[model samples]
Target: EPEVTQTPSHQVTQMGQEVILRCVPISNHLYFYWYRQILGQKVEFLVSFYNNEISEKSEIFDDQFSVERPDGSNFTLKIRSTKLEDSAMYFCASRDTGRGNTIYFGEGSWLTVV
Candidate 1:
């Protein structure tokens, strides 16, 4: 089965640096989302995008974060200024359809900020 794939399963960065986490969503899906889990916390939705525009975004998606579909297959999340609280597992997810559809997660891109 096709699955979402994330790069640099483990990332280490300083407290005030930039980081780009990459993801390749399922080929035939139309919607893309980014979720984050801060250590032992519940999964939190950051943003969702479809058709080249943002569908929804949570408050957690503040000024320092951005998402882009650089091409047909790649979806990327860029953090302009990392913080200690930014240490978390960043997940890339996608759903083929809506209305009771479930999102699938990549193993996760673990970001560690010191």
Candidate 2:
């Protein structure tokens, strides 16, 4: 099976700083997404993108967050002015174009804001 890949497996930054996480979705996948899991909490959806545009976004995705597919293969998530509460494991995900297709998640980029 194909897989999603993320960079900077772990990052530690000061509060109020900026961070950009990168991901490479499965080559054949058309739908991409960003999800985050706080310490021990359940995974929460952040945003989804397709066709070079945002398809949906959760309330958690505020002005501080942005997503982009800069090229054909790379997808990125940027967080501006990070906060302690923003510390979590951000997972990149992708799914093929089909009804109820399985969504595959990356190993995750762990962000630690101090």
Candidate 3:
């Protein structure tokens, strides 16, 4: 069964520092997205990437944040300057071609800011 794998399940970073969260979705889905859950809050969409370009993005995805598919295999989300507000569980997901609009969140990277 294909699944999404995220590196560094947990990460602690100092405020104003840089952090890079990596993920690999082992599927041939056309839509890839990054969603974050801040503590007890609901999961919020950050950005969506398709065809190697950003198809959609939320307000939280500012200039400080960026995502990339370095080699078309691994997807990386970089925070140029980490902020306290950025501390949350960031989930990297993609649409399951086997399923409809249902996305599989097999892996998520947690970020902590001090």
Candidate 4:
């Protein structure tokens, strides 16, 4: 079976710098999404991409954030300016064309901004 892979497992960046979180979701997945886990807050939705366009996104995904599928198999989230509050565990997920929505998460990429 195939699985998603993130380029960097952990990242530390300075505030005001840019950061790109990458992930290769399961090859057969038709829907892709990015979610985040704040230390003491609920899991939050960031954005969802399908058919090369954004299908849905939360208010959390502001102008500073963008998602793209650079290549057919890779999905990425770019943060224009990193902020300390942006530190969190970013998760990439996708699901195949099935009857039920069973999303699989990548080994989440951790981001730390100082």
Candidate 5:
């Protein structure tokens, strides 16, 4: 199975600051996504991107959050202004275009806001 990888496995940030989480999705996968798990909570979907455009987004992905496929290989999520509540484990995921394909998740980037 292909894999998704993320960088800065852990991060500490001041409240009201900016953060950028980087990811490298499987080369063959066409769809990429961002999800977050607040400690002890269920994984929540943030956004999905395909063909260089956003295909879907959840309410939690507000104006402060953004996703980008900067190049053929790198996918990124940016939090323009981090808040205390923003601290969570951010996961990058990807899947092939095939129907019913399994989505692969990265190890995740743990964000802690101070």
Candidate 6:
């Protein structure tokens, strides 16, 4: 079975720096989503994309963030400016189909902003 993969496993950066978290979503999946879980908080949705455009996005996806399907196998999330509050585990997930398919998470890219 195919699975999502994220790079760097852990990242450390100072506030205001640019950071790009990378992921390779499951092949043949139609919907892709980005979510984050702060150290002690629940997982929160950031954005969801399909058909090459955003299908849904949460308030957490602000001006500092952007996402792209850079290639057939890679999806990326870029944070133009990082903040302390932005430190969290970012996850990439894909749905095999719209109904009944549960979105699964990658191990995650743990961002540490200080």
- lDDT (CA) for every model shown? 0.95, 0.97, 0.89, 0.92, 0.96, 0.92
Q: Show the lowest summed lDDT stretch of 10 residues, model 1.
A: 96-105
The TM-score between candidate 3 and the true structure equals 0.93
* Candidate 3: regions farther than 4 A off: 96-99
Per-residue lDDT over 1-114 for candidate 2, one digit per residue giving the tens place of the 0 to 100 score: 678999989999999999999999999999999999999999999999999999999999999999999999999999999999999999999999989899999999999999
Could you tell me which residue pairs clash in candidate 3?
Answer: none
Better of 1 and 3 by TM-score: 1
Alpha carbon lDDT at 44, candidate 1 = 97
Q: What TM-score goes with each of the models? A: 0.97, 0.98, 0.93, 0.94, 0.97, 0.96
**1-114: candidate 5 lDDT, tens digit per residue:** 668999999999999999999999999999999999999999999999999999999999999999998889999999999999999999999999888998999999999999
> Taking the tens digit of each residue's C-alpha lDDT, what string does model 3 give over 19-48?
999988766777788999999999999998
List all candidate RMSDs to the true structure.
Answer: 0.8, 0.7, 1.7, 1.1, 0.8, 0.9
Clashes of 6: 0
* Model 4 weakest 10-residue run by lDDT: 95-104
lDDT (Cα, tens digit) per residue for candidate 1, span 1-114: 889999989999998999999999999889999999998899999999999989999999999999999999999999999999999999999988867887888989999999
Best of the two (2, 6) by lDDT = 2
Candidate 1, clashing residue pairs? none
Candidate 4 Cα outliers beyond 4 Å, as residue runs: none
Candidate of highest lDDT: 2
lDDT of 3 at 89: 96
Model 4 TM-score (2 dp): 0.94
TM-score of 1: 0.97
Worst 10 residues of 2 by lDDT: 1-10
Which stretches of candidate 5 lie above 4 Å from their native place? none
Better candidate by TM-score, 5 or 6: 5
